[model samples]
Target: MRIDYVINKVAQTHRGQSEGDVAQAIHDQLRAVGVVPNGRQIAQYANAISALPQLPPNATKR
Candidate 1:
């Protein structure tokens, strides 16, 4: 599975959600698909997603 793509997609869909909320969403989604990530991994994914540059309000994804 392409985890980076997953993270980005989750971040986009959950925009304006809290970091923890987003993390949990990612965790749940992965678990549904049988990729059970632990809490630390979820936190790491959250941190990595948070570190990405934010787009302008009117910006569109390519």
Candidate 2:
């Protein structure tokens, strides 16, 4: 699943933290999982998170 979907679901399921908090938790979890290695990688993750709606998946024929 996309990160934002996962984050929104986590936020809803948690039912207490703000959306930002949920996003942060996902970001941290990603880092812990070696999804990112450094600041530049984090930037890539940030852009991915921010543009979740606008960017279409490359999996679609293009």
Best by TM-score: 1
- Cα lDDT of candidate 1 equals 0.73
Alpha-carbon runs more than 4 Å astray in model 1: 51-62
lDDT of 2 by residue, 1-62 (tens): 35445445544443343445545666676665556535554444444455444333358676
Tens digit per residue, CA lDDT, model 1, 2-53: 5656776887776555678778888878877677677888887777666656
State in Å the error of residue 38, model 2.
Answer: 13
Model 1: residue 26 alpha-carbon error in angstroms: 0.7
Clashes of each: 0, 0
Which structure among the candidates has the greatest lDDT?
A: 1
| Candidate 2 colliding pairs | none
